[model samples]
Structures are given as structure tokens and as C-alpha cells.
Target chain A: MLKKHNILVVEDELELAKSTLAYLTENGFSPFHAKDLKSARKLLKQENFSAVLLDLGLPDGDGMALIKEIKNAKNEIGLIIVSAKDALDKKIEGLELGADDYLTKPYFFPELNARLKSVIRRLNLEVNQEIILNEITLLPEQMRTLIHGEELELTAKEFGLLLYFVSNQNRVISKTTLGEFMSSNYADYGFTDDMVYTHIKNLKKKLSGSGCDDYIKNVYGVGYKFTVA
Target chain B: MKLLTKTSLNFISASVLFFLVGSMAMYFSVRNIMAEDLRNRLLQQQNEFIYTAQQNKVMDLVSELVFVQTTQNKQLYSFSDTVLITNEKYMLYRKLDFSYAQNEQDYKVSILLSQSESDKLIMKIAIMNIGFAMLFFLIMFFVNRHSIKSALGVFYSTIRKLEDFEVTQSSTLSLDTAEIEEVKKLNQVFEKMSAQIRKDFISQKEYTENVSHELQTPLAIISSKADELMQADNLSKEQMEQLALLLETTNRLSKINQALIFLTKIDNRFYTEGSTFSLNDLIKEKLSLFKDAIQDKNIKLKLDLLDITHVYMNPYLAETLIINLIKNAIFHNKSGGVLRITLSNNTLSIANSGGSLSFSEKDIFKRFTRSSENKKSLGIGLSIVQRICDLYSFNIAYSYADEHQFKINFKK
Candidate 1:
């Protein structure tokens, strides 16, 4: 069994903090919530967390301060900023201050989950060297993907989507979430739903063409889910 | 009418009227005085004749030029003026009729003297006054016109300066002095009002931006909490439906927030101008990106492309504009509908074979005009397209003739 990573969520709003904690728990992670920057730092000192979801605005201080604090720690903790839409500059600033990734407010839980996994992987990857999802296998450190002993001709966008979906198994993902993930990699204008659908189509076609059974299931009005069942 | 032209016209007419009325009054008074003097001189000639012929009996020196004898009893004298022919020229004659006892004899005397010279002098005065009046009119007209033109020059210079003032380039409007007082007042008022408008605009933009930023925290909470509630098991169908609706609403609210932020950024000049980009390439790329969606709807696209369609604009905005236009076209289209795109020099047009538009074409570019059955659209896409086109001074027009068409004429 995979060891569940612990995450610390720093948010001022009680409802948002509760929702985030609930989501983390549902996804099988041990989660802690702090309503302000002071408690967040205190929690960091008392126990170890795999990642810190930092909201930029807090009651006593800006969540932005936590990025620098986390960076200076002896064992570095992954920092993921959760900011409002207009805080584009602060997002960049936080990243420069040794934060690993950031998510805009109103972000989906699946999207957050995907980002958390990504950030934690970069900070400290899992001990298991290989990931197996039925016929497909992904070696994160090698950046190589294979299916049924055949090499995949995957574009950079396709490979990134495959990796995120594989890592976040059984999670429903919206078009906005996928587009944002792709744009983060390319640093281009965030894509539209149509583009996301196109990439997903290409990804599904390539995977299925390689003698793999159907894995990506559309959730009708909700979004698409990547699950074997 | 221009102020100068109007005032100059009024001035010319007023001066001309004054000169005419003045000259006419002078002419009548001078003529009346001249006629009275002629009558007085004629009466004096009659008295001198009586003194010479009757009192001194100096009949040898009496001249017969203006004298006539008449036999009439108790005659009284009367004087009148008449015109006479003298050397084929019209002359004035003042005639006097009298019966007087001269040398103790009853004689009726009729005397005449020429008043033609005084009449000619009056005529000359009338001619001089008319000529002088015309000269005065001409001089005053030119003076009035020159002063008006110079005053108008000041007005136009101030107006031209005002016209040249762009809000982005200049913080304050400066005006040259105006000789016209009313124009000066106009300038002062405009300067004050424009400055206030600029100030108010900045404040309003700042407030909107701040509100938009502040809404994000609460909105995120609402959305995430709603999503969490949706994942709970054993929920009724009604609960699930309500949650789904709530999520959709939250997503729309978020889109509106983003749209407003985009507006504030554009207004704040966050995107700097100038970059050469291939518009053709962007359009083609966006079309390809939408291929899957279009295929899902079974839509066919007809393309007419030029060899090159390069344009000068911010590349990011250009891409966004194209994407919005294509997205709007695909989203509103009918299944198996035909989408036609034409790209040429400085022009690009998109036509989609959708049924009649739900709203008027004029309202299509306005914010929040949802003209289709698609619930996923926020109705802000076309307005954003219009705004981006407006920022670049590109003329975009929408029309529906068997198919809905949006055409943009780029400024080269």
C-alpha cells in the first residue's frame, strides 16, 4: 500500500479550509487545516507535512510569507499557492520565493489534487520506481512511458496529460483544469475547452491504438474521468 | 454657423444700415437748408429791385433779366420754385409775382432768378455722402473680417489643441489664450470637466478591479464547498440537481469575474502595444485546435485564405481575439452546418450556418448577450472579441444574410 502524504492547508475562510481538508481526506491523504499564517507556521514546526497549500491572504499576515519560511526549512516542504485571479504578479513572486506551484482560486479539487501530487513528486518522489496502470507503465524519473512493450509517440502535451491523469487515478477532471495544466507546461495562453477535448481525443486514440483497453470515461455534464472501472 | 462668420455677417449688416440711415438723414437736411437759402436770396432780389426803381428812381440800371410788368389792381407777391430749360440743361428757377406802385404807376412785377448752382452743389453733396458711405462700409468690413479671422484662429488653435489631446498620452489639457471671451469660458469649462472625467475614470476602474479581486476568496469557498457536497453519497436526485446547478452558477460567476478583470487590465493599459504577428497562422492554429469540437458537432468549415495575413498587434491579444471568434462560431453552429472563413489583405470574415440569431446583431457585441441554447457559454466571448478589435482600431461588423457573418477590417 502507498503511504498517504500529509498536507497542510492555510486558508482564512473556514468553509474553504473545511472543503479542502475534506477533499484531502477523501483522496486518502492525512490533512491539517490552519486558519491563519501564525498557526500555519506553528503547525509546520510541530509536525511534518508533505505539502503546504498556502492562500495568499490571511488574517494576521499574508500567506506569501509562508513560502520563504518553507524554503528556509532544513527539509524543504512543497509550497503551492492558492490565490485570487488578479494575483498574477504574486503568483510569480511566490514561485520565485521557492514555491513549487500555484492554483487560482475556485480551482477544482481534482485539479488541486493533481497539482499536489505533482509538487510532492518533484520535492520527494515515491519510493516505488515504476507506475503500472493495467497495460501502460510510466517511469517518472526517466520521463518515459510505455504500453504493452511498445514505445508511445506522445507529444509533450500528451505526455504531461497522461502523467497527470495516471497519477490522479479515478478523479474527474474539468476542461479548465486540464487546460490550465497544459498551459503551465507550455507557458502559453491557457487553452479553450475545444483544445482540451482535442488533446484528450488524441491521447485516448493513441493509448487505445497501442492495444490498451478503454480507460478514459466521460462523465457527461461533469467532465472526463481517467479510471479503469 | 461659425462664430466668426455669424458675427461678421451681423457686423457688416449693422454698419451698412447705420451708414444708410445716417446718410439719408443728412441728405434730406442739407437739401432742405439749400432750398431755404435759395428762397431767401430770391426774396432779397425782389426787395433790391423795389429800392432801386421806386425809391431812388434809378431806372437806367434796372436789369430786365428777371422782371416782367403786369396791369393788375391790388396785387400781392407770391414765390415758387420751378425747373427751367437753360442751354439744354435742367436748371432751377425761383419765380416771384408782385403788383407794386412803382413811379406812382400800377404795375404787376414778375421776377425770376436761377437757383441751378445751389441745386448742383446739393446734388454733389449727396453723391459725396454716398461714395464716402460705401468706402466706410468696405473699410469696416475688412477690419471686421480680419479681427474675426484672428479671433477665429485663436478659437481653432485651442480647439485643435483640445482635439489633439489624448487621454493616454497627456495627463492634463493645455489651451492657448483666446481673444474671444466666450471661447475662453468654453475652454476653461472643457478643461475642468475632462480632468474630472479622467479622475473619476481612474477611481471607477480601481474600484471595479478591487471588488473583482476581493470577490475571488468568497467565490472560491462557495465553489469548493459545493463540489464537496456533490461528492457525498446517498444524496437525493433533487439534491444532486441543485448541487449541479449551484456549481454551474459558480463557474459562470467566476467567468464574469475574469471578464471584468480582463476589462480592467485592458483599460489600465497592462498590455502594451506593438508587435508584428501572423494573423493567418493564428487563425489556422485556432481552427485546428477546434477540430475535435467541430467534428463532434459534424460541422464543415470552408476556408479561403491569402498567402500571408500579417498584422501589427499584441500577439497574445491577437490569438485571444481569433480564438474567441472561432469559439463563438463553433458554439452557436448547427450540427453538420457549414462555417465559411475568408482571409484577405487587411480583412477577415467568418460566417456560420446557424439558424436566425436569437438576438439582434447590434446587441451581439454588447456584454452578456446570450444568443444561443448553449448553457456552457457565458455570453462574454463576442464582447471580448469586440473589445480587442476596438483596442486595435479594427472595424468589426456582424451581419446575418442566410448565415451569420462577422467581418473584421484591420488597420494596416
Candidate 2:
């Protein structure tokens, strides 16, 4: 059995922290929450965490200080700043202080999941980089995929969407979430619902044609769910 | 007229009028006093002639300047001016005629006094008066001009400093000290006003940032909660669709809030850091960002870069200016529409194939004015573009012939 990753969510907003913690738990990770910088510091000392989702604004102090603390420690812990401020300077400063990634507020859980997993993957270099679900094998680093021991061709955007789906499986992802993800990762283009629909259709066609079991299913005509069962 | 010139002119004109009237009065008064002395001398001479005629013969007393005339009737004393020819030159005299009774006979006695010396004295006095007045006026003109200029020194400096004052600058407005009461009061008022303005400006900036922070946290919470509810398997299709709508509405609201904050920042001149860069390269780079959208819409892009124009502006604003314009053009375009961009002679023209607006053309750049078909558009892009152009004094125009066209003139 694979060991679960320990994630720390540092947020001041109680409701937001509760939702984030629940989301983290549902994604197969052991999660801890700290509502302020003082408690966060205490939690950091008592536990071993693989990654931290740090909100820049905390009750006691700024989360930027925690970024430095985590980076300076002997153990490697992935740091991701989740800030309400979309200020460019703050983003640059967080990254410069050893944060692995940054996410603006009102973020999608799937988006956060992808960034957290990517950060953890980067920090643990010896961990296997391939994601496998039965007949499907995805080599994320090389952007290559295989089904039943046969190479499958996918475009860059298709490969990105597949990776996003695999990371966030069995959950209904809304079209708005998918659209935001597509626009942010791709050229910041206005990704319409039709465009997202087309890309998913093409990706689904390619996956089924390669003799792989269909994993992606539409949920109530509102969203798509990548079911692995 | 300048204040100094105005004051100096007034002083000079007043002095001239006073000098003219004073010299004339001095001349008349001096002539009267000299004529009175001459009349007294002539009277004393007439008294001496009457005594001489009483003692001796009255005709003998009339020599060169004296004259005795025999008259049938006695005359009262009188003085008259007479001219005599001596050595063929006319000489003026003051003569007094009086009647005298000597040796039981009536005699008319006349005494003459030369008036040339007194006339010469009056001329000297008039010349002296004028000379002294002119000198006094010249001195007063210089002193008056210098005093006024010195008094207004603080006022001029205040004006110069005000001309260079920018609210974005972090320095306080400090004015020079003044001896003049009015100028001192004026400086105090100005200093107080500037301080108030700075305080208001700083508070306004903080309010904008605080609003963004305060609202975004709740939005984040709401969105997360809705996203969680959507994850439930027991929800019906109607519930799921409603959840989706709620999420999209939250997202839209957040976008509108952010756009308003950004507009306020631009209006407040927040992005003042500047650099010089090539517009052509910037357009090309931004176009690459929209390449997928263009392909999705099947937009036929026609780009003509006739020159490498280097524009000096805040790099962030420049990027926004180009992005907003390009986004507006692409998003409003129809399927299989032609998107044409041309840059030449310090001008940029972006045209897209779209039908004429259902609304008024003048309202195109107004905020929140969008077509009925594209309800998804935020409608603030063109407004932001117009604001940035206005900040730099660039001329922006929108026109429609066969397509919607936006042209910008970058020349000052």
C-alpha cells in the first residue's frame, strides 16, 4: 500500500480552512489545519509534512515568514502560497523566498490539487513520476502516455487535461473549473464551454480508440467526472 | 501687467502729476513775493522824491529814472510797468506814479525800478524745484520696485513649487517664510490644503486595497462551499445545475470587483514606473497569447508592422493597453471574421469584422455597455484601454465602415 502524504493547510478564515481541510482529506492525503501563524509554527514542530498550503494573510503574522522557515529546515517540504492578493510583487517575493508555487484566491480545488502534487513530486525526486490507472500509464515528465503496452499520441493541451483529471479522480469537476484551468494554463484565452467540450471529446475519443477503458464520464450534463472504479 | 510694473507705473504717474502742480505753484508764489519787494522799493523811492521836491524844485528830482510831470488835476498813487530804450536795448522797469503838493503847486512824481533781476531769480528757483523733484521721483521709483519685488519673492517661489507638485510624490509642500502679512497667510493656507489632500489620497489608496482583501476572502469561502456541494452524489440534476450557476456567478462577481479596483488604481496613477520598449514586439508577444482563441474563432489575422516604434510608458500599462484592445477585438468578432492590425508612423489601427452596434456608437467606450449577443463579456476592456490612452494624451478613435476599426495616434 502506498503511504499517504501529509499536508498542512494554514489559513485564517475558519470556513475556508474547514473546506480546504475536507478537500485535502478526500484527495487521499492526511491533512492538518492551523488558523494562525502561532499555531502553524507549533504544528510544524510537532509533525512531519510533505507539503504546505500557506495563506499569506494569517491572524498573528504573515505566511511569508513560514516559507523561509520551511525552506531553511533540514527536511524538504514543498511550499505553496495561497494568497488573496493577486499582486505581482507578492508572487515574485513568495517564490524568491523558496515557495514552490503560488495560487490566487477563489481557486478551484482541482487546480490546487494539481499544483500541490506537482510541488511534492518536484521535491521528492526519487519518487516515481508515472501515474498509472490499470491499463493507462501516463509519463508526466515526458508528456507521453501508453495504453496496454502501446504508445498513444496526445497533444500538449490534451496531455495537460489528462494529467489534471488523473490527479483529481472520482470527483465531479464543473465546467467553470475546467474552463478556468484551461485558460490559466493555456494562453489566457477565453475558453468557452464549447471549446472545453471539444477538447474533452477529442481526448475521450483518443483514449477509447486506444483500447483503454473509458474513465471520463459526464455528470448530469453539468460537469465531468474522471472515475477510476 | 506684472504686479511690480503696475505698482511702479502708478507711483511714477502720481509723482509726475505732483511735480507738475508743485513747480507751477512754486513759480507763481516766488514771482508774487519778488514783485511785492519791488513794489515796496518803488514806494520808498517815491517818498524820497516827494521830500526832495518839497525841499527844492520838483522838476530837478526827475533825473534818468525819475520823472516829474505838471498836471492840472492831482492823481492817486499808481504803479505800472514801463519799457525804456537804452543803448537801443529794451529794459523793463516798475514805475510808481504819485501826486505831490510842493510850494503850493501840484506835482506828479514817478519812480522806476529795474525788474530784470527778480525775473532771473524766479527762473533759477523754478529750475531748482524741477531738478530736485525729478531726482526724488527717480529714487522713489527704484525703491518702490525693489520693495515690491522682494515682498512677492515668497509668492513666486510658492507658485513654482506648486507647478512641480505631484500628488504621487512623497514630499511635503514647504513654503518660504514671508514678512508680508498676506503672503504669510497664503502660504499657511496652501500648506494646510496640501497636507489634507495627501492624507485623503493615502486613505483612498488604502481603502481600495482593503476592499479587495476584505471581499475576496468571503468569495473564496463561498466558492469552496459551492464546489463542495457539487461533489455530493445525492444531488439531483437541477440542484447540480443550480450549484454550477452559483459558482459561475461568484466568479463573475469577483472579476467585476477586481476590474473596478484596477480601474481605480489606473485613475489614481498607481502605475507610474516607466520604461521604453518597442510596440511592435509587444504586440507580437501579446498576439501569441491569443493565438489559440483566434484559431478557435477562425479569425483571419492580417498584421502589418511597418515600423519599429519605441514608446516610452509604464511597461505594465503598455502591456494592458495592447492586451485589452486585442481582447476586445477578438471577443466581439464573429466566426470566420478578419482581424487586421497595422502599425505605422506612430499610429496603431486594429480592425475586426463585426456588425454595427445595436446601441449608440458614442457609448462604445463606456463601462458596462455590451452587446446583447455577447453577454459573457466583462465590457470593461475598452474602457480601460481608453483610460490608458487618455493618461498619455494619445488620440483614440473608433469608426465603422465595413468593419469595426479602432485607431490610436501616439504622436504628441
Candidate 3:
């Protein structure tokens, strides 16, 4: 059995932090809490955590700045930022700063748990291979995905999108960024946010219909995040 | 006339000075030359008189008589040949009787040396002619000054008008033919520049407004979500408490950002051409979207809307205007107050019962001008309304009675 992962939740609101800790603890993981950057740093110095849930708005300093510090101190540790900042640029910046995932505020707790697990699984991967989550197995090399031990058919673009999501796993992806990543000929193909939405809708239907648990959650006004609960 | 008068005065002064000196010099030179010639002639006559007196005494006597009569008196006289009085005071010559005397005897002369009274008469005549010439020069100077000054006045006023022209608040300044060709060219250039600048300013304003407006909805969602998350009970107590404050601050910042971007876009003229859509339909849709808020406020809405939905305008801007206006009414209205909205024949009017407007009718349309009591208000709603009207050539008017009234009349 994999060792129980240690997770640190850095936030300011006491009730929210306590509830988040309870949620993490109940999900078979040890969770720690810090109200500000100072306490978070103190906790980090004493313990090795598998992942850190960071909020960009902190009492002491910016959450994004702390994300950088965490990455610098430990390259292997997974970092997920929970922010209310929904701008495309901010999302892109957080991800680029070595965050394993980003979740906008007011998120459902199950979604957060799912994302954390996804990040942990990706970080633990030793070699490129098929990822097995519940009944769904995604083969990165073959660009094929299986649900309930049955090969699922996906369109070329749909396949590519699913693969990219699986590759990134827990991260919140913006449509603009995803559009660019999935196709080099987006302009020629007249790709738009609506098209991305359509593809995501279809991808979600296929996964669920094929007996695969729903892993894609819409982040409202931002984009989608693929993770396992 | 003013320019002409000024130029004429300058010309008159200069010409007067020139003519005064010129006429003086001319008169003096002419008088001197004439006097010298007269004196020389007189001397020559005197010498001739002596020569003839010696060579032909009878002819000399006749010449002397003629000279005396011409110089000394107006009266004519005759003398006898035997009267030879040659004192210094007078001269007598032989008198000539034309019928009986021989040719040598026919010439008779007399000389009278008398008073200088007659010399004044000759000098007076010369002075009169000089005076007439001076008067003529003065008249010519005044006439030229008057005409030239009038012409220059027209030219100067036109030039001044062109030089001090402003393009923002007014239409093109009228130009008359009195303006010189160069000035006319300058006026044309100014008109063209003003038109181009106006065009460019409008387009730039529109672009900024559109960009800012486009960015607002997404930002709002981000901020609201963030706030909700921070308030969620799922987080650890400490984490939840810390994030709540962060969320609030972020929410305020995002609101400011949205307002600023909206104001910037509105001011920059980022208006797109609107398609014909039912104003009534759009309003109904918008109201439905705000249904929850309307219910929360317990405000009664009275909409006397027409079936007409076709309005030629940028649908986005029109919708924005309506949203802001309705939102403003809802926020400002008294609890359980009536909100009235009426649309007819390209006119949209909204009125809500509430406290008197926080600003004068004029101040209401200026950006960032909120009611003094409502410090939290961003104060850009009415300005956005005004901007939409300006961009689409709509006429907007404000009035206050029992409640504030905003009326917008769209151009066909």
C-alpha cells in the first residue's frame, strides 16, 4: 500500500481551513493547516508534505509567491493553488510556476479532493504507462483510453484533448490554452471556446457512458480539471 | 471695418507726414526758383532799360512807362515827350502821340518808384496755389487710408478666426472670401485635422470600452467564486478564516477593476453598430436575469413596454445601458418602492421612486460622481448611459419630480 500522503492546507479562514482539513483527513490522508505564509513555512520546515493547497491571497504575502518558494525548496512536491482569481493570465501564471493544479474559489470539496489525488498519482508515476483510475485506464503511448476494460473510441481531436488532460491530470486548464495545445491549425479550423465546450461535453458523455467515473469537472468561467476522487 | 479703420489710420498718419514735408519742400523750392527768376528778369529789364535809354531814348522812354504801369499801379496813364524828370523817386519819358508823332517819338516811358503795397498781391496768389496743392494731398491720403483699412480689416478678422479655432465643442468656423487664399488653405487644413482627430478619438474610445467591457463578466465570475470558496465550511478553521479576508479584498479589487475597465471603454467610444432588437424583449430578458435580486429587494416593477423590439443600435451597448439603468434604479429605489420603465417609438424612459438623486441633473451624467451618501457606489452608471447615447446619436434627457427620470430618444 502507498504510504499515507501528508498534505498541508494554507488558508486564512478558520472554519474553511478546519473543514478542508476534516475533508482531507476523512479521505485517507493526513492533512495539516496554516493560517498564513509564516505558519505554512514553519510547517514546511518541519515536515515533508506530498502536496500543498495554497491560496494566492494570504495574510503575510501572496499565495503565488509562496508557490514559487515551495517549488524552489522541493522540486518533487506537488503544488495546487486555490484562488478566486479567474483571469486566464493568472491561471496560466500559477500553473507555470510549478503548481500541479489550480482551483478557483467556491469550489465543491469533492472536486478539490479529486484534484489532489490526481496530482499525487501523477507525481508518483515512475515511468510512462497506462494510468488506471477506477475502471478507466488511459494509455499515453498508444493515445488510447479504456473504460471498464473495454476500448473506448474517441475522435482525433477528442483523443488529443483527453490525452492532454490526462497528462496534466489535476491542473485547471483554460480554454484558450487548451485550444492552442490541442490543435496547431485552430485558426484554420475555426476553433472557439464553444467548440472546446462541445468537445468537453462529448468527452464527458463518452467517459461516463463507457462506465468510467466522471473525472472532468467544470470550474465555471475558467475551464475544466481532470482528476480522480 | 475694424481692420480697415486701423490700417487706414496708420496710412493716413504716414501719408500726412510725407505729404506735409513734401509739399513744404516743393512749395519752398518752387517759390525760391520763381522768386529768383523774377528777380533776374527784373534786373535784366533794368539793364535793358539803361541800354535802350542810351541807344534809343524814345524806345527806352516807352519801355519805362510800360514797366512802371505794370509794376506799381493798376491804373493806366500817358505822358508827354518833354517831361524829363529823372530824380531818384520817379522817371519821365517822352509821351507818344500815335496819330502825330514819328516812330521814334511814338515810344514814351514813365517810371514811378512807390509803395510796396502791390507786392503782397503777387505773393498771395502763389500762396493760394500752394495751399490748394496741400489740401489735395491731404484729401488723397484720407481716401486711400479709408479704403485700404476697410479691406485689411476683413482679412485680419478672418485670419484671427482661423488661428484661434477649436474643434471639440463647435462646428467649423465660417470662412468668407475676404480671407486671403493662404488663410483659406489654413482653414481647410484645420477643418480636416479636427474631423480626423474626432474620428480617431471616437474609434480609440470604442476599442478601449469594448475590451474592458468584454473582460468584466469573466472577472466577476472569478471574484464571486473566490469569495464563495473562502466562505465555504469545508476548509480547516484557520484556513477558512484567513481566506475569507483574502476573498473579500480580492472581490473589492475585482469590482474596481471591472468598473475602471467599463468606464475606460465607455469613454473611449468602443461602440459597435447595434442590430434591430426588441427593446421590450431585451428588457424582459434582462429583468428575468435580475429576477432574484428584484425579489430580494421587494421592489415593484411597472413596465409600460411597447411591442416594438426593433432598434438600430449596437445590441451590446444598448443592453449594457439598460442593465446599468435598471440596476441603478433597483439599487437606489426605496424598499418596496415602485420602479417604472416605459419604452415607446425609440425612446426608453425609466423612473423609480426613491430619495432625491444625490446629484444635480447635470452631475448625474459625469463619471465617478456618486451620491455623497453612497460612498461605495462607483458612480459610472449614468455616464455609461450618456456615452451610449452620444455614440449612437441618441438624445438623452434627465428630469426629477417625485422620482428621477431618464429618457433616451434614439435617432432613426
Tens-digit lDDT track of model 1 for A1-229: 7888889999888888888898899888899999988898899999888999988878897777778878788345788888875545677798898889888877777778877886777778563467788789887666677899788788777888888888667765655556656655654342456677888899999988888778887655445667766
Q: Which order, best to worst by TM-score?
A: 2, 1, 3
Better of 2 and 3 by lDDT: 2
Q: Clashing residue pairs in candidate 1, if any?
A: none
lDDT of 3 at A193: 54
Answer with 1 or 2, whichever has the higher lDDT: 2
- Worst lDDT window (10 residues) for model 1 chain B? B56-65
Q: Which ten residues in a row have the lowest lDDT in candidate 3 chain B?
A: B92-101
> How does candidate 1 score on lDDT?
0.77
Q: What is the lDDT of every predicted structure here?
A: 0.77, 0.89, 0.66
Instruction: Say which docking band candidate 1 falls in.
Output: acceptable
**Candidate 3 structure quality by residue, lDDT tens digits, A126-182:** 335577767877775466878888999987667767766665555455454454344
lDDT of 2 by residue, B182-229 (tens): 999999999999999989999999899888888888999998999999
1 or 3, which is superior by lDDT? Answer: 1
* Fnat of all models, as shown: 0.40, 0.68, 0.00
